[model samples]
Target: MDNNLEFKTIIKRSFLDNSKRQLIINSDYIQFEDKDLATDYFTKFLSSEIKDYRYGVRWIRGAKFTIGRDYQIFIRNNENKIIKINFKSFYGINKSLHFKNYSGILNSLLKFYFNKIASDFIEKFQNQLEFSICNVHFSDKNIMIETNSIIKKKQNTILWKDVRTKDYRTYFAIYSQENPANINQCYNYKDDWNTAILNTVIRTILKNKE
Candidate 1:
């Protein structure tokens, strides 16, 4: 196989389809071990650390597929948000994908696996997954109320987003991808590497002002 042509082909295939888009729901609903825990954690973060910032949380995945200690927070639209998420992931994917790392290939959507982490832990079991809430008002029946882009489906280069008038947010925690050896070959994890990946997504969203 011509390495150059193969690489290009891989890139094209991996690229999101421009037209085929759907709300790939990671789960129907988030379940918390204790409902109060969710409320408490939210209260603490919103009050102290994130008090000044606007509203955005970016959880960077470690090499092991776990949440890293160092997470990025955004209040107002800062340049750092964009720099850390999208661009980095694109670069990493370009390099790692060609290596035939199963993790890398399968990780295009790891929410499926990440959800598994919450299953065994009681503390985490109670926390909720990210959701895009939707509502319709009587005055404007035609207006869309809420939609979140937690899980996106795309066709080639085309992407479609759910447009309801509510906030789209997900509470994410990652685990390292090491122990789960079975999935490692395809999807490897590195500590702090995903900071760039998360930043890449943020930057992409920012560029489009979404």
Candidate 2:
């Protein structure tokens, strides 16, 4: 465990409010609950319970409010009840420093994910098993996608070597080797869950391509 990644800090709830929120991250889980003040009161979500996670630089409520890495995790227990804790941004005026905090916490979550889940996916892919994330499906040799067109959607299979991925500010798109200028699949950063893992899995597999 990296000492730098484990730190807790309390930030004021709002501009004039005195209620403080303590944000902490460790190798096990990320804590966002402030027992008395936290609206969601999410104590924590362990790696096993987490179904999906997303973090990136994006707008929260509207255009004026921008939060870096919208830190959120989707989790469900054995009962299949879901829980999500929303992020609270810092006050305006020289608020950039808070991004470091977001990065640190997110990195810890990343470490937990990589150690617990990511390696499993990578190993499964290497073992030639089919798996799906979001709407895209991965096979031993190719990625199956539904290409979107003006007229209708069509299923397409592009080999691992021929597949290409594009990342925009708000969307992640996959392209085939056909160069048809059609999107094999497009996923919104907000709506699509676990995009970070999807992107990493693609890159790692492609890098070690045989």
Cand. 1 TM to true fold: 0.16
| Residues 1-210 of candidate 1: C-alpha lDDT, one tens digit per residue | 343212111122134423211111122221111112434421111111111121122344777673422222222121332111111133244444434332332232233322232222212212422211111111111111222234852111111132111111332121113322221111112222222233222233334435
State every prediction's TM-score relative to the real structure.
0.16, 0.75
Model 1: how far residue 106 lies from native, Å:
34
Q: What is the C-alpha RMSD of each candidate to the true structure, in Å?
A: 22.1, 4.0
lDDT comparing candidate 2 with the true structure? 0.65
Quick one: best TM-score, which candidate? 2
lDDT tens digits by residue: candidate 2, 62-81: 56655332444444443555
Residue-level lDDT for 3 in candidate 2: 75
Off by over 4 Å in 1: 1-56, 77-139, 145-210
